[model samples]
Target chain A: MAELTTLREAIAGLVHDGDTVALEGFTHLIPTAAGHEIVRQGRRDLTLVRMTPDLVYDQLLGMGVARKLVFSWGGNPGVGSLHRFRDAVERGWPAPLEIEEHSHAGMANRYVAGASNLPFAVLRGYVGTDLASVTPTIRPITCPFTGEELMAVPALRPDVTVVHAQQADRAGNVALWGITGIQKEAVLAARRAIVTVEEVVDAFAPRPFQVVLPGIAIDAVAVVPRGAHPSYAHGYYDRDNAFYTAWDPISRDRDAYRAWMQRHVLDVDDFAGHLASLAAVA
Target chain B: MTAWDTDEVMTIVAARELRDGAVCFVGIGLPSEAANLARATHAPRCVLVYESGTIGAKPEVLPLSIGDGVLADHADAVVSVPEIFNYWLQAGRIDVGFLGAAQIDRHANINTTVVGSYAEPKVRLPGAGGAPEIAASAGEVVVVLRHTTRALVDRLDFVTSVGHGTGAGARDALGYPGRGPVAVITDLGVLRPDPATRELTLVAVHPGATADQARAATGWPLRVADDLAVTSSPTGEELAVLRDLRARTAASRGGPTRPVRPTGR
Candidate 1:
């Protein structure tokens, strides 16, 4: 039902140029390795999607991979602004970024609609707000049940959706716990879904509130340990706070960002190589 | 006893706004710190909900972000982002919405989207995540910000979250259910919306903070309440708990955690 492949193979074969890709992770279980792989392969003209679009998106944006960003919010987490994202939006240093903003509710409903094979999602959002002026997709619609008007946003069926989880069984059914986010909805909504996991086990032990993506739903599974490095994988490891703090400085300047990407992400053969480099440094 | 900074004072004032058993929709940074402090002290039963879908999270350490694994681990339940905003926030289950504003106008309209024009901004800020809905539907809103002349502006560059809009009936006419920004907590003083005008008026000044200083910091004509009371200094118990929380957070993160200070420039 699902093919077991390497991260590089998954990125190259499944992810293509000009495709709408969603790297869906709230703050936890961020698919940073897969994002790095996309950058390494040098995919361009891609519309990257996420709720927050944290450091991974920042990295991709800095590397000039994203042509557009469809997101609710983009930042450097507990720190401050995403400088590279700011540069692209403010000055168009690497490239000009076209933004389609939405509220978290609107974006989530978009994915839900996609997953449910619906044309659009309805919600009480963007009412009396300036967001409607900038985003054309957010439009008011009259309800059938009642005469009241509500907001509607089209379904977000991305070309590819990538996420990181704690474990996957050999059968390709992935299990992830703790702030699973909209990974399930994003994966089911995508034409292709790539899941990177910390480990592949014989069978999942079944934790409380675990989301198990059936093998048939997944296109590919890549066993990339510590896949969500700066972000955490719940039971596997704690979030690397030091790295998140360090990213602010590394990603602030154009030169520093490029050099860091060159050394860490682009220069590495794969995620393992990236890990080795970090280990070597430590 | 550890000496409290202005930020701590600001947090203490913000924490006092939360009522026991109230459902608070907490934004990250100062709001999170203040909400957590309230839960740890007076508002023990306060239900904390984060945008990351963690509901009733009780983190021993300050969360690095809303989606910090610790939040999920400590949460009573974790729902989807859509459910959080729609089912909880927009449905008006959240009694209090804690926010941090970059720029707040005289009418309490907040600007967290940009510093200049929408098309061409001098500084592009982190756009609204769930703040719009939270501000619209939460029973009340508490704004925690580092008070400065630049932050307290006459007009907002962009309205990321609508507080009172302009006057009393402004938010109601817009069809929002909740009472918009009830209080604005700053390092110098606390500003509450006038029932009639909906304008945020300086109602109380913190200890060692002068009313003139608070008035001087506001961009518009700051109205001092006729019956303005001095905000009581933070109790030693409150300070100790807050200090311990910060220490634990710093130890966990391998560095000291500090609240964000927004600069309009």
Candidate 2:
């Protein structure tokens, strides 16, 4: 059963140095607060896994918390490049970050394989692309029955998977709707999991197309309202598009990025404090 | 028709490529705009599948990202990411995989990965998201990118997705199920794969864009169709709808009326 806890306690108990951590959210319901808490706890050398390593991953990478990144795409969504990610990959500023890349299909399948407790996942991907040539994890496998060749990718089983959701019941069952990307797979695939929710309710209202993670699968549930800020929580609020565009300039320069992080992340007591700081600035 | 920009014509031309009821796996940015335009105008039944697991998404305004809340709110079904990739895309349910790239070669191969060496320095672009499989398994693929010598390159820094791999028999040799890129829509014009060589050839130039200009913009000695056609200008209705969409998207995102050029991938 999941123990209801605070975000700081959840991060301290669940995440560790050199752990393989996945903060799974596509665009909506991203665990920004959890990621911030992990940074605050000063974890180091984590092998961070995500499909699209957006602003949160960029922050973690900028802070030198990750030694490697296992992901598909790394960009600022509709805006531009994740400048801090580029700095780490290109110039090795702060640290030389290693990357193990794959296509979205490949990454998604890996998570599925992990969730299923399989060795590897097969797909019709990277056949004629250079991804297979560079990433040793992607290999060609011949079908035993059909005599057709396909690609095989090893399963991704993270040590800890963290996700943000709309709500959690008193029983600790987490439920989220609206673009629930790969959270379920990531949670099931990990050894332990933490879910940060907007609120802990008595019962779920049962929204359409909602995914509910049973308390049995989760290690802890943290209540942090507006936890997915910058990213949205479907009905709670809209995505902070202005902040995304604003990130480009701040992340472009190293000094600026560090100063911004020091003020918004390191100096803040918690996610609520971080939110207050942003509001104070705005 | 009223005055229109190059970007408008390119988007309109790309939108025209979609069949009325085709299932399009839409990439964000330009491809998303084009697919949405088709739905808003001609192809009302055109299904838009975003990789974010929102199948048949029908958003009122353009999504800033692939996994925007509006997409999920308006989607026919919201499956898991794994199901979207395996059961839908890899299963060959997608009819058209519309994509945009930073660099494309003569054979339509894409490079959204890097601008230089893989091991070392230069620009590190966003790695392949779903383009590899989309380029491989979709029934057919349509690519859109701004035409410049830098973008229409002879050699890619990295091959992120395979189009017509080396030449004619490439996909056949590799046992790929889907037909490779059928059309590459750009600001200058449209380039369709030559049936004989499987090389992208200039089939049509957009209005006000000359064949020489297209050739100059390409890095290689670009091939031209024997009877190269000059594409018709964007119709008034198309321009109006496109502008309206852009305006609404801008208002929602707190952005300028015209969006900045999208980054690689």
Candidate 3:
């Protein structure tokens, strides 16, 4: 059975320095509160992984917690570039960051391979593209039956995988809905998994199109309400479009980004405190 | 019929390029607008697929990102991300791959990754999501970008997506199943690949745009078709539907807050 614990305890016990951590979400249900707790713990040298490294990953990159990034795409979504990411890569401001990039297809199949306990996955991608030249992990393979060529990428098994979901029952079964990206595969592909949920209920009402992770599969479940703020939690709240728009300016400058993180992430004790501080300022 | 912005004219041109019942792999920004416009106006049966695993998504509002919930809300099916690429895209099920690029070269190669060297210096644009596969696997790829010398360059600083490679047969050598980029639509006009050279050539100019102006805007020594023609102006109904769509998109939650235009010029 999964242990029910606080966010800080969950991070402290499960995640460690130099672990390859994957926080999976499509464009919603981002485990931002978990990211904040990781920052608050001051964990360092992590290999951060995601399909699209949005604002949460940007915060991790800015805080000098990440040493490497294995991702397909990194951006501010509706906004422009991630300035902290740029600074790390372009100028090595916080630290010299290493990047191993792939296409969305490539990364997703890698996770699928890991979930299946396969050595690698095959797909017809990266052909005639520059990515193959840059990322050595992508290689060519031939079909034994037809002699056709395909691209192959190794499986991605992270040390820890964290995600945010809508509900978790008292039995520790987690339920997620709406735009479920690779959360399931990501969880199964990791050594340890943590799920932060909007609420802990007594029993789950099964619904169509909902993915339920069995209690045995998860290591820990933490109740962090509004955990996916900035990013939405599907039916619970609307995406903070105003904050996304506001981030472009705040994250554009180095000093501004550092100051904002200091106040919002580092100085705050927990997610609730972070929310309270935000409310007080607003 | 009515005064249309350059962006509107570009959208109409892009929409006309789509065939009815074509399965188009779409990206965000202008490609989404063009594909949605094609569905609303000319190509009503066009199937819109997003990389977020939403297939046949007919959103009432423009999706802010590929992963916006509105896409999944009305999608015919929402599969996992791997299945969308391997089974649908790489299997050659997509008839058209519509994309937007930050930088494009004479060979139609696109760069959405970086502006300078790989390790350092200059701007860091959004890296490729599904474009590399979309360009290589789709039966045909179409690009929409702003018309500027900087955008239409002689050589891209980095090639994020493969088009015709350097010339004809270049992409084939790499075992790409698709034919690569066939057309490029810009604010000024349309560019098609030359049959023999595979170099992008000016085929048609939008109204109020001149051949000389188009040539001057290209970074390379551009070649114009001997019988270049003027694009037919947007019809009144077309403009009305396109405008209405934009208005609705701006009003929709999780949609563009401002007027939709091409980014990454």
Choose the strongest candidate by TM-score: 2
Ranking by DockQ: 2, 1, 3
Candidate 2 chain B, run of 10 with poorest lDDT: B256-265
Q: What TM-score do all the candidates reach, one by one?
A: 0.97, 0.99, 0.96
Candidate 1 ranges beyond 4 A from true positions = B1-3, B261-265
Writing each residue's lDDT as its tens digit, candidate 2 over B60-119 gives 899988899889987899988888989998898999999999899999999999989998
Alpha carbon lDDT at A246, candidate 1: 86
Q: Candidate 3: which pairs clash?
A: none
- Cα RMSD for candidate 2? 1.0
Badly placed stretches (over 4 Å) of model 2 are B257-265
**Whole-model Cα lDDT per candidate?**
0.88, 0.92, 0.87
Candidate ranking (TM-score, best to worst): 2, 1, 3
What digit string (tens of lDDT, one per residue) describes model 1 on residues A1-282? 778889999999999999999999999899999999999999999999998888999999998988999998888888889989899889997989998888787899999999999999988657777787778999999998986778899999999999998888888999988898889999999999999999999988868678899989989999999988888888888888888888898888889899989988988998888878878876
Candidate 1: residue B139 Cα off by (Å):
1.4
Please identify which of the two predictions, 2 or 3, would achieve the higher lDDT against the true structure.
Answer: 2
Give the winner by DockQ: 2
TM-score (0 to 1) for chain B of model 3: 0.96
The alpha-carbon deviation from the true structure for residue B227 of candidate 2, after best TM-score superposition, in angstroms, is: 0.4
Count: clashes, candidate 3: 0
